[model samples]
Target: MNGYGSRGSTPGQGRGFRPRGGVGRRPYPQDAQEAQAARPRKLSCPPELRDAFVEARDFLAGLIAALGLPARLGFGGVDPARDGRQITIEVRSLADAPDRPDERGPDGRQEPGDLAILIGKHGATLDALSALTNAFMHRNNSRDLFFSVDVEGYRARRVATLRSIAQRCATRVLREGIALELEPMPPSERRIIHLSLAANADLQTESIGVGSQRRIVIMPRDSAPPVEPLEDFE
Candidate 1:
């Protein structure tokens, strides 16, 4: 969610987060499951898809090792949608991950190596890794698909946390009868908040702000006024 779409004179912090789809109730999905579900499935499995899956997993394993993580993977699996594809690989442990920065080199000191650090501020690095995997696997793609990487159970845990945050904020908003703002979060997390509260008929959720500073505002449905829609990318 980008650009603050102010709702009346409600008081809050600097503008908050935005998510996929344009402003105005865009539900482009915020999590891996939703993303995979969004894809259209093919009726029959294509032969090349099996090869693609094997190729993708093997490639991912190599990529992980090349990135300096070895034996850290618990396992990875594929979720084929009739004809589409979704492969998820996991980095199970950071026990072997360095707690300190690497030796100095011409490029300057390297930061400590950990899957968590590689996950970036909001799974940004993970997204990049996914894109890279797909790029390498594109030739094997007899069908379009989505590829993603997760550290431990981070994504799943985060989804649960976001839902908790949403519920907590919603309760406060309803109790106080005023709009409330939440801490800044990425589009994916924001999407979870939106999805978690989507069923409440008495409440409304709005995302505001631009770039990394964006977030969500919880307010009453009857009191919600029209605000320009915002768009966000995972």
Candidate 2:
């Protein structure tokens, strides 16, 4: 006999075996269907802002191409902050293009040392790019629009690291009953440090020093008993 014994006969058991019901199809759960139907959809952006973001993305794309960089621009999003007075356009580098001196490697992996060239010491290059892009927008009469260019999510990761450092230093200050001074950071980074410690009542934050030398000082609050004044007697 062949693999099939006869018409409508089970493959292995000959005439005695019968096929089970619903063998080819699994039933979908009603609750899961309901849940899927109830799930919320993503909200769409306002038309004017979306158009402006598209224009900004195209502008950056052309600029990157002109610079001969082996990278492509990806739109992150447009975020409005400072009570909607300021708009920030976030752009990411795709970096799928061929290896460049500071981009990729022959093995198709990112080179740390090369990437440091673009990021610069303490993200100076990245900040410069952001400022330059914002200036471009201003020159185009975009007005109040800013741009932040990040390669491979570097800025996001750095912000997280800064916040963690702030928390750890705050904890140490609370325990040691002494103040700690952090290394000099940019105004934006210093703001991150200050905001990270803002909610802790046992510690306080202060930024001091000249422009480039500015840093954050995490200090312990003095909660000790007050000394009584030695009055009278003369």
Top-scoring candidate (lDDT): 1
The RMSD of every model to the true structure, in order and in angstroms, is 14.5, 23.4
For model 2, the superposed segments whose C-alpha errors exceed 4 Å read: 1-46, 62-67, 80-115, 223-234
- Report clash pairs, candidate 2: none
lDDT of 1 at 154: 52
C-alpha lDDT score of every prediction, in listed order? 0.54, 0.50
Question: Which lDDT tens digits does candidate 1 get at residues 1-234?
Answer: 111111110001112234334365323223444223222122232455545554665676677677666434423445644333675655543332234224322222221335455466556777777788788877655446767776544555456546655776677678768676665677878888898999999899888889988988788888954332223212
What TM-score number comes out for model 1?
A: 0.59
Error of 1 at 62 (Å): 3.3
Show where candidate 1 strays beyond 4 Å. Answer: 1-50, 74-84, 94-113, 224-234
lDDT of 2 by residue, 112-174 (tens): 422344465456777886777777777857476566766544555456556656766676667
Q: Could you tell me every candidate's TM-score relative to the true structure?
A: 0.59, 0.61
Candidate 2, residue 96: lDDT: 31
lDDT of the structure predicted as candidate 1:
0.54
